[model samples]
Target: MIAPAPGISLGIDIGGTFTDLVLHDPALRRSGSLKILTTHADPVQGILEGTRRLLGEASVEPGEITRVVHATTLFTNALIERKGALTALITTAGFRDILKIGRERRYELFDLMLRPPAPLMPDALRLEVPERVKADGTVVTPLDLAALDAAADQAVAAGAEAIAILFLHSDLHPAHEEQAARRIAARHPGLSVTASHAIVREMREYERGCTASANAYVAPMAGRYLARLGAELAAMGIAGPLLLTLSNGGMTHVEEAIRAPVQLLESGPAAGALAAAYLAGAQEPRILAFDMGGTTAKLSVVEHGEPEVVFGFEAARQARFIEGSGLPIRISTVDLMEIGAGGGSIARRDAIGLLKVGPDSAGSEPGPACYGRGGLEATVTDANLLLGYLDPSRFAGGRLPLDRRAAQAAMARLAAALGITAEAAAWGIHDVVTEAMASAARTHLAERGRDASGFTLVCTGGGGPVHGYHLARKLGIRRVIVPPEAGVASALGLLTAPPRVDRVATLGRRLLAWRAAELEAAFAALEAEARGVLARGGWAEDAPAPERVVDARCVGQGAHMPVTLPPAPWPTDDAALHAMITEAFTAAYQERFRRPPPAVPIDLVHARIVLRGAARPLALPPARRGWEGPATAHQRQILSGGCSAMADIYSRPGLMPGFSARGPALVEESGSTLVIGGKGRFSVLENGNILVELDA
Candidate 1:
């Protein structure tokens, strides 16, 4: 093995179909990347193999790598598949059914048989103890130690591998919950335990309980996976500090990740959004990040060089469009909308003989029929193959050769059912999936009071560029930017992430009767907590100053909006502090609602602080100056605009910065392909990103 070089960073992203890896030397301004089919049985196997290949191809030794950052969808998949450990919940005696009762609001009012997601803990495993804590941190009744012991014993007898403890109003008064946790830990040292107050200190009981239950459910599995991965990497002679990306567009150490795996639910997609923001922020202040992989498509908005952040999101929804149909997790995460439209989404005719695309996919194991992996059903990839949009011999960098005949046969079966030619059926499938994605984009934007026409579309992932032009045209977007190595962009994103942690506390105080010292104390405590977390991740020395935000609302309003506040050492006078807070809140409120409300008393609900560590920026390699070789590598017949045309094919790497191509062209690379519509004009930017301008 060649001696390792210093200062090399390795980033790995595990997707549904592929595990992408990127090894870059920031100082050298160079990079090497690889894509391997994911091993469903053991994801670590794919990660190890891809790592070895990437290091060898880049001519660097494992010891030379200084950092390893990873993002995966494994935990999210476990939640959706219901493959987590047997978990039990321990709560106040009368509030045992809080998980099941939920908010009691029907997500869908008209459906005759509406089914909400089942609680992570069933009734049999939900053991309760006699405890009482009021909403104001007052103890209504003392906790019964004997009752708590009995519940612990019952949970153990029921074969629970993990236990979640949620005492009523514990967010404000955590002493009782802490006492119970210590007792349970002492009795069952082998079991994993999670407490509601430790995870989220907000007001809602149901949401906090759900969050704790989810963390306990996935804790055992995530711990084991991280342990095994760490052992394997150590055995491979890699001495780098392993970091895991969080769903909030930040990275944390392996130990912190194991403690709170729920924060990693959308980690992979968040990385993709962050990467888009970094690459396109200079050219466009506002961008719509569209990432289409093998199993799903994700959309997120990036404004002013940062992705929007949301405090809560749902997972494993029974109905994608309906709220409250899935498990609610209250964690800071990048705001994104995900739909089941991707390359491997299955296509079939409905009961009434109407063609439909998926909310289900033929994942990597039996990937689209074109991969010749025993799949017979027609899928989006099969349709793309029949439409001549994908090269059979070059798929997955030639690691997986696609079978054109198999794709044709699969489409033929669907075409027979539709009573149309295979080509027409293929077009129908393509158009259907494209429209599904566009419609979803429109709805997502509308909900934010924004329109798609105002944002530039930045495309990434394997299927993103292939469908970017059509989706852009549908959304009334005129420009699309496809960065270099777009297929592995998320892995590249992992390289750019900074170490960060967010902490929140409930204040629940009225601004009209507030004290400056009390407010300062609350924010200071949150900053200290955030700093400790960042310190554990090896960012203690140069962590950036904490950013503070407070959730405020009209005294009687049920909800609150987040207001960013200036750093600590606030005004010493109470009246001055109140004026500052009210002014900031009013400004933010007016911007959001388009008008200011009448003079009213406001209350502070929660205080939040974010701690970030500086990460070195990646330099873009200089682009080739001229296109000396033949621009047209070959010609292939493709279906577009309801007709077939001979599209000129070009090699993506061979195109220089000033290279330009008209519509009816295909730009091919190792892992992705860019399809230019008949009326689109494509050009290469200085940074090697391809810009395609759509014709209205």
Candidate 2:
């Protein structure tokens, strides 16, 4: 092991199928990377393995890692699998029915079978305490200590390993909830407790309660896993700070992550989006970033050089598309839409005589049927293989030789079910799955008032390049860029992220005639809280300045839009601050609703502050001056333009930047393959990005 060194950053991203690690040494101008299969039973194994490989490749000691930035899907999986510790929710007496009441709207209008997601806490476990606070931060009912003690006793006896305290409107005043949590923790010495006010102080009782419950739900798991990981790294002589990525596109200390694991639920995907945003360079704004991993595909809309920011997202839902059908959580997150369309996405026909691709996947264990590792179901990989979109012998840089016969046999089942030839069925599955992804992208963009045609698609991840061109065709996107080492893009993306934290408070006050001094104090408090977290994450004293924003809206609006705020005194003049708030609302309103609402009293719903440390740029490998060689004539028949054509096959790595491959050619990469159709021309970018352009 080498000694601890400065200017070295380590990033680890644990996805459903793979755990990717990247080690970057800024001073040396070099980076090392590894992508290993995630051990579902124990994700740490994958991390350790990947870390060891990266360190070995870089010839550096574990101590050389000055920072370890981690992102994992463990919390999201725990919620989806119901594998977290037994948890109980403690809420204000009158708000006991908040979870049951929900927002009172069906996700589907016509389906009578719609079932809202079951609450995380059961009625028996949701012990209520006698306390209340008005929406305006005014105390309504004094907390009943005797009743609260009784509730705590009941929760402890119920075998709860953790407790969540969420008093009604606690965002305005956390005194009651904080006191309740302290009392409960004191009584139950070893039990983990989560207070809604501490985790996320915002409006909406259901979202607040749900977020706290989720934090408590994953606390035990995160704490134990992180502790073990830290020990493992220590054993290897790495003494640097371990930072975990957050859904807000920032990194937090491991201690904060252990306390609020829900914040890391969508962290992995957020990193990929950040990478796309960074790679888009000068065209950052109005770009669509597509990340297709082995288990899932995530889409994020980048507007004005920044990804859209979302305050709330759900997880562990039975149905993917149905809103209000999953565990709700309130956290600052990079706005993203996910679908189960990736390398291992299973493809088959449903009972209604219709073809279906997935929301279910084969994952990495058995992987695609073509991998020939005991998987029986046909998947996207099998479909691609059957259609000559993949080279069976050259798969994964020859590390994994795909069994074409296995892919064919699997597709044969689908062919029999659909009453079509195996070849035709395979092609249909490929086309339909591509259509499904394109449709999802279109719907996601449409809802946000975005047009897919105007944006350049940046594809990454293991399965991204395989489907990038087809997805582009379906979306009518003329240009697509597939960067070098596309499969490891997410891991590389992790290195470009900053160490930061987002803190918010629910004030719910009107600006007109409101006390500006009090508001300034509240903003200061939030900023202080954010800075504290940043400092704990080991942010350098001379790092870039922190950022602050507020979630505001007109009094009558149902939703709040984020508004940026200046640091410090926060505009001394009441009129000036009001004008700034109004300006922010008008700009955000036009972006979302396309029009600002008529004059109405403006309200400051939530004050948010973000602190971040400066991040170093990623190092790019210089491009090769020439191609691997000319493509050899291959007699494989492929369906294109409603006809069959013989295509030529070529190696991917052999192709150099500025190299152009015409349509009717098969370009094969290690983890994926690209099928260039007629009228399509593919060129490599300066940073070794593969650009595929199709003529209309």
Among these predictions, the greatest TM-score belongs to 1
Quote model 2's TM-score.
Answer: 0.94
lDDT of the candidates, in the order given: 0.88, 0.79
RMSD of candidates 1 onward, in order: 2.2, 2.6
Tens-digit lDDT string for candidate 1 (3-60): 1234888999998888899998877888888988889899999999999988988899
Give the Å error, residue 345, model 2: 1.6
TM-score of each: 0.98, 0.94
- lDDT (Cα) of model 2: 0.79
Off by over 4 Å in 2: 1-6, 136-140, 540-545, 566-570, 626-643
Q: List the residue pairs that clash in candidate 2.
A: 2-61, 628-654
In model 1, the Cα lDDT at residue 639 comes to 91
Please state the error at residue 454 of candidate 1 in Å: 1.0
